[model samples]
Target: MCGRFALFTPVSELTNKVGAVMPEREIHPRYNVAPGTWVASIRQASEDSAPTLEEMWWGFRPSWAKGKGTQPINARVETVATNNYFKSAFAKHRCLVLADGWYEWIKNSSPKQPHYLCRRDREPLYFAAVYAERDDGGLGCAILTEQARGSAADVHDRMPLILDDDSLEHWLAPDLTHKETIHSMVRHIDAGLVEHWSVSTAVNKPSEGQGDELINPL
Candidate 1:
């Protein structure tokens, strides 16, 4: 699961690649992103509108399910299409969680060995996600996860659904609501293109969350 990750890349640099109207709020860089905190997400106001960058709560709890008292940070891809809590968002509110990389732990380690995963070239990453409006009016989001692949499988059995650059437009197309079309047209970044390294356990502590050292290989 993508419980903790980082996204210090400037929004100014992402405009070209993400094809979104940048947010007006000054976004500070974050080295250790945790659930419950707001993070940058690329989405559309409507099917006819251009994509835009906005701050979104990291936990997802649809307004209709507010009484359930749950805010999940990740949703399993396998059940996302049929699960009542996620099917609507999966079909209509699809979105992208912007990040530089993510973290995973080896459960058997004395103190789990945390590893940072990112592109070999260190470019920005777009994670498949879905969002909903909370009763309080906040936009909450949940990252999509599937069986781990490539080196990510070595650290954990599940990993965030990383999207291929070419599929960004298709994934955001509002008219394409059927899961069948999404599955056939959208694609995940090749697992082989992603890489990881052992990092300071500082990432394990959200309080020591800022600065580049947290991602520096130990």
Candidate 2:
């Protein structure tokens, strides 16, 4: 699950890459973006308009949830289409969760090492996500995950559904709701396209602010 991640890429760079308008507010660089925080997302404005950037809560809360428990931050791709909590969003609220990289802890090791996972070419990782608005006007989003493969499998059993440039448009199409067509667009990115390395354990703690030290190799 994508419990922790980082997105320190400049706002201007993101605007250029995704063709979305810059967020009006100044966005500070983040190194350890934890769950429950606001995250940057890209989604189509309408059926015929360009995609736009939005800052949404990093958890999914359905309108009927009544705000009483933990919201889900990651939804399994295998069951997202049929699960009650995620089906509607899965069908209509698709989005791109922007990040430069994410951190995952290796299991069965004393003082488990945290690893940074990202594209081998150092490009941004556009995670597949879905969003929904709560009754109180709050916006929430959840990252989609598929079974882990390659080196990522050694760290955890699951990883975010990272989308390529070719998949972005279809993944964010506002009117595409056919289950099979949508699911087909959410295929796994080849493991060879990604790389991972051990990083400082400081990421184990949740805090805000940017620092290269957080992602520095250990």
Each prediction's Cα RMSD? 1.1, 1.7
Best by TM-score: 1
lDDT of 1 by residue, 1-218 (tens): 88998999897786567579986688988989999999899887687799988889999998898548689999998999899899999899989899999999888886778999999988888999999999889899999999999988988999999998899888878888899999999899988988999998777889975898988988
Q: Write the per-residue lDDT of candidate 2 for residues 82-114, one digit (tens) a residue.
A: 998989998888988889999999887668789
- TM-score between model 1 and native: 0.96
Candidate 2, after superposition: displacement of residue 110 in Å?
2.5
Residue-level lDDT for 82 in candidate 1: 90
- Tell me how candidate 1 scores on lDDT: 0.89
Error of 2 at 117 (Å): 1.0
| Model 2's TM-score against the true structure | 0.93
Model 2 score (lDDT):
0.85
